[model samples]
Target: MKKKLGFLALLLVITMLVVSACGSKDEGKSKDSKNASGDEQIELEFWTMQLQPTFTDYINGIIKDFEGENPNIKIKWLDVPAADLSKKILSAVTTNTAPDVVNLNPTFASQLAELDALVNMDEAVSDEDKALYVKGAWEANNINGTTFAIPWYLSTSVTLNNKAIFEEAGLDPEKPATTYEEAAEYAKIIKEKTGKYGYFPSMDLSLVLQHMVMMGADLTNEDGTKAAFNSPEGLYAFEYFTKLYQDGLIPREALTGDQRSTIDMYQAGQVAFFDGSQFIVQVKENAPDLYANTIPSQAITGKSGKKTMSVQNVVVPKQTKHQEAAVKFALFLTNGKNQLEFSKLTPILPSNVEALADPYFTEAGDDAEPTDLVRIVSASQLDSAELLVPPMKNYDELRQAMYDAISASMLGEMTPQEALDQAEQEWNDILAK
Candidate 1:
């Protein structure tokens, strides 16, 4: 009787162990069932700079549409103010909590690319996909031969001249200045005839760099290791601005003031021309009288017949868990259809080639408004406008050095040669680091 009872106890213990093992196996299988079925859900975090308050509806609608099409993928969106975007991104990267994808201008993106903190979009994007964007926009995100971001929106400066001011200055509003030299000549005439400042070049906007590039100043030497803007080309560029300042062609305050000062002067009918993005809307809304007399013209071309373009792009971080999904979402966000939709909400131009072909951008009838004309003109110049400052690791430092030299030269504190030499040496030292 004792042996039989022991056998029964052993059987019960074995049975309990078998049941527990089977239950554990079943739970493990259940957990992986979604993966086995290729239906696992993926979550992605996306960040945008200063786009929420104005683009809330558009962004939410996009999110809804994207999720509907890609049921297995979900996007968590965050809108950050433009000023805080860089700081937030840096902090997130340091803490390994970076978003999967984020919006950044090429200038800012270059900084991260240098640190190898972003994915190489060139390898992720196919040749066919690359052809879909504007050539300049597509190339602008390339850092050290590898593209790191997808171009989203683009803005090339166009000349917005006050027709009344032009006429008052004895200049033809219809035949606006097409080059910087011509613009200087026009400025002189306008100031002489109308007793109003012809134009106020926004020096604080770093336009002096654009002017240098337009004058054929090589920004960096071979391999981009040292500064090359101190060459003869750079001297010519600096002297150009110095002459403008010395002759009083541009506003005296421009040496220290921002683009807003010039915009205000333009609105108050104190200036003849204002080169900027599609600002006709602001003029139309703030000063209707000035808008009525505004005429839109093509961007002022340099000797190379190229203008400068400002580009914003979408980029995926290297820390993303879902790279393929993040890239897919980025492509979707920048596709021609979506980009066209976004362009409708703002005056900015689209980077998508197909979007650029839309009638909304191509057509500017005789009866078109000044804003419409500006858009048309701005779009037409994208093919010829290049990013003057390409993606460089030390771009911010280099730009500041160049700007400091320009300011010193304009203020008569330093000769153009001395300023260029100092800037070139400083840039080389930065590169050496």
Candidate 2:
């Protein structure tokens, strides 16, 4: 599963110029004030999406420790409901009252960076600081070689197999497929032996872009001015889906449905494998028998031999008066120590290289839960993990274009190459605007 970030669209947009130099009186001097000793006391406002009562204690602790270290700077924390972030941020920037530091996902961060509303992190952070994070994690929100945010936490999928299904198919439960080719083989065996579908490749319709790239296909030209996924690699990715549908390897419903359909099939015990770790939680609650038969494993790679990651990031607004302090607190908030603590509270992996190297991520102990092994496997992938789709303009439209075209081919509405041609033209058309 992709990293879950709470975002509901009020207005699907973000952009604006930097606000004026100092905080205006109407904007509240509380954001910037002087202490009783006449020392400059800078209050930096921080905004995060949907991190409330659950993380209150942890965030408060970070703020307290940071304030203790940098007495002159105090953080004014605000938690915005995920659904309102887009509209509120767009409004905030337009109104010149944006927060000093904001937590965002790659999608929103990319949009803001495109408008120059966020800080240029590459210019603000030193190479030493950048080196502290995973190469892929840190670059998740880097658009056109310019970074606009600091990496916070990352999420990678863990493919969950049904042990009973595997054993019924005469496949060893202990040795699951590590790549899509092996997975297709397992699918054939499962369908032949057990009469159940193999796996759900199109868990997320948007993931078509990711899958194409994973299969060693480029989505765009050298300068990203034209679509390039109509090449041989792209044709192969399309043909993979079409072949599965035609051969009855995956569920026929997968051609018409998305992630929800995959979940439904898995919960009904009609599919052998699911493509994410979080799905097991639902299975445990909804389908106890399937949950009992669950075996968590690492995600399946495609031809590229790379793992995919989703990141949550932190960005400073270009208009913040406390640039240095805001940046320092952002850095402090995402440091290895703090990241390790957050990772414990959540199943997510740390972006920090040192934090990821902690024993907690590497060793789940002898009596570890199936999930513990899942985390360990996922952590191992971080070395190869990257934001495979990378941030692109009109990404939703691009994903939709690819999804629609590919799905049409899978349904025999068109040939695979024709599907790629249509998708490529649609993408180039969107990019042209």
Clashes of each: 0, 0
Backbone clashes in model 1:
0
Instruction: Point to the candidate with the largest TM-score.
Output: 2
Model 2 TM = 0.91
Candidate 1 C-alpha lDDT tens digits along 146-249: 88899999988888989998887777899998887888899899988988888777776457778788888778887988788877778988888898998888
Candidate 2 lDDT over 163-218, as tens digits, reads 99999999998899888888899999899998898887863655888888888998
Give model 1's TM-score versus the native structure: 0.90
Candidate 1 Cα lDDT to native: 0.82
